[model samples]
Target: MICIRLFQWGIFVALSFVGCKSEPQNQDQKSIEKGIERIDVTEHYVSDSYHKRHDGFDWVAVSVKHHGDESLWVSVRSRADQKKPTCTYDTKAFRIDKNTYESTYDGKRIRFEFFPTSLTISTENPDDSNMLYFFCNGGATLAGHYGKIDGELDTQQIDLTTFSKVLNLQGIGFNVSSIEKDNKNTLTIFTFGLENRDYNETFTIEGQVVIDAEVEDLNSDGSPELFVYTQSVGSGSYGNIFAFSVNAKKSMSQVYFPPTSENPKINSGYRGHDAFTIVENTLSQRFPIYKEGDTNASPTGGTRQVSYTLVEGEAMRQLKVLDITEY
Candidate 1:
């Protein structure tokens, strides 16, 4: 009886160990199956194997990342014989669906269609071949299908620093790019597809970094307004806004944004880390209010939200605070 009891205890221990090990294996298998069905926008891919080995065949490589919720930053490179690249393109692709994207470069509309395992670049109108010839050389074109790669791409193969976004509304488009140059930030704003507006401006920003941008028609006018938000590069993260309104659908004029320092009531207990967004036709700014004994990292006080309405000021159209709330 003692021997039988000892044998039963040993079998129980063995079974318990097997159950624990099999549970993790089952979970890992489930995770792999889930990954197979997942459509991750941020992926790296390369051309087919034939192009990679042959000298005459041109090879293309691409990498993509999420620019915003509705757009992707795509970087592409094509080369032959391991020599200088024949084509290089880096820009934003606005999403049309879950797996489709579109962009306009040099006045031509390019489409990017993604499948489960491959990506294809083409134009909506096959007759418009100028864009393909213009972006590539040596008879190599940026239009092709590519296969997905599993791991990280080589760092030297793609542009990782530059920030770009393309915003379009009504028939007008704005291509905004930002780069760090000479210890300061530089922004270039270019307007396209406008009949009477040739709005291309560059600004040198000091002590701040461009965070995000939005486009809206505030007053229900036919034309739209562009707002660029910036934040200081430090612990404070003080925010600023640069805005431009389309004038009668022909030209654009700068819209003034009031500084917080001038408004004593709103400026009290303000220590930056602000967030701005457009709710309907009104612009809203929200930040944490700090009490007298609060620290920069931790603010014990509640949040302060300021709502502004667009109005014609003495000098130009500016944002006038309509109400302020604390909660």
Candidate 2:
């Protein structure tokens, strides 16, 4: 049964890479509620620590399964060769306590075991496990012993105080699930199990991208019309994205992103993750209106009506598209 669950998530990852998987996640499970799914979990986990790697500042991230309320998982990364110089590194780990015991990852001896490859803890105890899962540099950058990059915690008092007071998500485990580049300068924030739930975290978001929106041409001219976007976050317009038109007074009118079929179908009606801006990255799926002939377009981008000539000298009216990448 557990293997089935992992397989399900694994398949989810696969589908995400190749567009998406439409199957809704199991909503009855308690752990599933942590973030609704792995994407939300990883988004919340990475938060500000996530680097889009635009100019080469990338984070080596990894994750482990929950061992029945296990707490504290750590990540270790180094550029030096581990086998030659005896493999010592500046390792980072998450902290542990009673209330957050089930919410965090414990990184004890995370450095010693998975160097040059990967490591898995071998201990039977959930809290004080003595095993480290290790792997070598491969597709997922497998590292040998002491070479794993488990999610680390901010042990500093300031991070602790601010995280506790602001996010109210202290001790909750973090990891990078699926990262996608948005627009031309931002990254979409998706966490493990963030759907259907609202997280109030101490986040720094610049240039708001509205979700659950609509677009209409009020001038009777065929264009990407007035943009009406929204800022909700749950069922019944809670986590809604809004995109609409500018009214007569130059204010935003009520319109939104078309509900095309290409998006990952959520249990709720119409909602999506925040849009991110990134350079040379894929635009996330959001704020679109569903209509015939536009069903197969890439889910996200600044696509709008354009008149262009094809090679055959045929005039075609279509929406322009952008690039797509896993990030």
Task: Indicate which candidate wins on TM-score.
Answer: 1
Q: How many steric overlaps are in each model, in order? A: 0, 96
lDDT of 2 by residue, 4-123 (tens): 000010100000000011122234432333332221111112211223323322223233332223222222222111121111111112213221222112323332122122222222
lDDT value for model 2: 0.23
Q: Give Cα distance to truth, residue 111, candidate 2, Å.
A: 19
- Model 2 quality (TM-score): 0.19
Quantify how close model 1 is to the true structure by its C-alpha RMSD in Å: 16.8
Tens digits of lDDT, candidate 1, 1-327: 000000000000000000000011244543443345337656766666323334455455666777656677666544323555555555557778767787676466788666665666778778764565554556656566566677754333332323455677878887676767557788889888777966999988888876657788886788888888788888888889988888777888889988875778699889987868888887888888898989999997898889888888787888888999999
Each prediction's whole-model lDDT (CA)? 0.64, 0.23
Over 4 Å off in model 2, which ranges? 1-61, 65-141, 146-152, 155-185, 188-327
Error of 1 at 234 (Å): 1.7
